[model samples]
Target chain A: MFELLGIPPQALFGQVLLGLINGSFYAVLSLGLAVIFGLLNIINFAHGALYMMGAFVSWMLLTYLGIPFWFALVISPLVVGALGMVIERTMLRPLHELDHLYSLLLTFGLTLVITGVFQNFYGVSGKPYPIPAALTGVMNLGFMFLPIYRGFIIVMAVIVCFATWFLIEKTRLGSYLRAATENPEMVSAFGINVPLLVTLTYGFGVALSAFAGVLAAPVYSVNPVMGNDLIIVVFAVIVIGGMGSIMGAIIGGFSLGLVEGLTKVFYPEASTTIIFIIMALVLLFKPSGIFGREV
Target chain B: MTHTIEKSQADTPGPETQAMLEVQGLNGWYGESHVLHDVNLTVNKGEVVTLLGRNGAGKTTTLKAIMGLLKSRSGSIRFNGTELIDLPARDIARLGIGYVPDDRGIFGSLSVLENLLLPPKVADGGFDLPAIYELFPNLEERLDSYGNKLSGGEQQMLSIARILRTGALFVLMDEPTEGLAPVIIHQIGHTVRRLKKAGFTILLVEQNFHFARELADRHYIVQEGKVVDQFRNDEIADNLEKIQGYLGI
Candidate 1:
């Protein structure tokens, strides 16, 4: 048993592992926010609520419908993404020409509605989602002990983040999405159905959030208000990373998570406030964000 | 100044050649600002026309209105005998009409090759990569450069080249030579002549009198959002002073 700075190695490793887990969530969630903001220019306030829906939907599938976790993983995101598309076409489409505030307000109201419905049915108490049988063990790596489920989460988050980056930076569809984000009229002039593109982008953006939610289901409590709290942290990560930068979102998430984890080790009281403090300092110096190009 | 435009009467379509594009009583606005008013014009098949005007004379607005880019536009815009007044910009583009704006809307973040390949092929005759490269060798040289990184002339060329790849029968080019060195301007003029020879109908908007005179078969003098005057290529020689006077150049 090794000790560094008066903290035992196991305790330090435990906190670091927890930080990685939280970082994974931030990376995936912030990636969604970035994608949505890039294309729609709307800060999706309902993202947290939608993420909660993903977890709850997966929970319900297993509890009432006898659906396994594997099947629920695929089913939950699809359901949430379909709902996201409906939201875009019906609520967000008409607000496109107006100020961005309207969309934000609308999504905020939607967040309340969705969270309220879930709370009404399920209440506030967190429900446990049993970890799958295959990932129900711990790995001891000399200096640290890692839960297989947490390692799975970290790996999944990294894969999802990189896959999203590759999709946007290396593909033709991504080129159109990026081009449309810059100038929708010009992209439309190129004969692309930009309205349809916008609709799909919104759906895809929220789908990423939902996918993150599915991933979080096993780790965090499947509670209605779970996303409401996590989303704020993700927003901080976005501000620090730069809005709409794929690479920035991914890196910002993990780095902030680790910083928070390290803070927990040094001063337990400041663990939560450190992200906001860093966000403020980053805003003061690099307002465009770490990866953001000039707006 | 160096040459009077070769009047390509042989290339100009006859009066019986049905109009390729016709705009009747077209009106457009930017919010409350009325930009184009009662603009009526026609582009006959295989003819290169110019919309000659000073800045903010509604030349660009007319082109935008025809392309359905302006949301508050009304009246008639008929392309290839099909009514196009209410079509979305995307639908209008899909109908085989291409636009090259004065600002040259190249995606700054995208590479030159991406910008060139961005526009989808609209018809069978659209320029392929080899043809586009052959037409503008400069584009081939800067294939990997970002759109914003290109020189002004290169951006303009890329802008024009992008539309040419769309196989659009009618191209509405707005001030293609707004700011360019003489050599690049000369090259654009040469390209315009070659396109006209290749049977592409063009409705060009230009503030440059010398450049427009060299490429346009007919000229429409726009004054404050209205079509104030029109003259044939032969009439251009006699009306050079009038054209200059109208443009206030």
Candidate 2:
């Protein structure tokens, strides 16, 4: 009954809702990257693989133990986050004194090993994780039929991002983290246990990615390489947002997803390349990013 | 060479004369370049001891070694009879040692209040907020401002004010009076005197002989990464020329 700009409202609104869903994942994942990079000073290249593991952990929990989506949701992140702490302590601790590149390569190598192991076990084909019973139906929002589970993803992502921002910005522990981010030696010299704070920060950051993984499992397929492709886009989202800025990551992620979605509606051929184009433009003009300050 | 290994007979702490810190044969290196060869010194309880030397003569390095900040160092740093060489900087701090670095490490992103509250409490009996405010009224006035935005004297006061709240009995001050206006230097000297009266052991590193001579009870002349000589405050009048010769002032 209604058409705007030669495009039907259903198609436009449909893609916009889909864009919001993808935006939720991007916001959560990029937020994790920013937090980790800020405190640990290392690019977590294994993040995508960890996201995949979160999905796998949930899948395994449901398939083998007859656990449901709700329980798997809570368990998967905890399990993955515990593993993250182990990675930080055993693998990354020794390289603390080395250059940032070493940790990046190490995490990248971890990505390969994790991907290889998952591929060996699960094969390239993806598995389908069913939507929970309560969220199976779609809500008719006059403009579009919105999937309830998709809306839940968006709401949950906002809650998580807000909580993380509050923790880093408003609390005393957050003040310690910010100070440590600036100069860890002085923080530790002040008698705060900086290494312990580091491990906990890394664990929490990884858990954010794992949370996104579980959220993506129901919408996307539970595949070993599921996060592999999405993570590249998330990195571009971070670059456009600014490398270590929390607000930048959240705003950059959601807006870019919308841009990508609208591009699909207006020009289908350029949807995938639009984010990279913006990234290149941002790097050329403001290398520190929109929210990042001068070094 | 003549000092004890953290427990020299000359520095033996007793009830009447308590030795707070004893650093013996402290050798430090920045990667391959050795900065400190043999640094032997002692600071008794409530005594303000100054490590007087020219720039780069290992005075700062000695303080850093004592604080366990250096990457590589070999020495005995004892605080209250505890061997501190093997401990981490945080642990050393927990042992009641407060550090006010030469550059005055103040976090730019944090507010002045946050910087003052940055250090966790290491012991009991430290200056409370009201007391710190009384000492440095400028900090209380600039509580809402960002740390790096403060003036140099304010930054120095913030730097020292931070650890004073931690209840640390011993303070390692590296050039607190350096690069300050004359009025600020005089203010710092006044603060140091008050702190001494209140019974805080101080290990000061200074190129300013006049500042050292006024505040310190004893002075150790450090040259070429070693402690060349030491004397009491009364001995300063007898060895003023010798002290000026060593400091090259």
Give the alpha carbon lDDT tens digit for every residue of A74-136 in model 2: 999999999999999999999999999999999999999999999999998999999999888
Q: What is the C-alpha lDDT of each candidate?
A: 0.89, 0.89
Provide the lDDT at B5 for model 2: 18
Docking class of 1: medium
DockQ of 2: 0.65
Question: Deviation in angstroms for B128 in model 2?
Answer: 1.8
Query: Model 1, range A101-142, lDDT digits (tens) per residue?
Result: 999999999999999999999999999999989998999887
Query: Candidate 1: which stretches are off by over 4 Å?
Result: B1-16
What TM-score does structure 1 among the candidates reach?
Answer: 0.96
Q: Give lDDT: candidate 2, residue A38.
A: 90
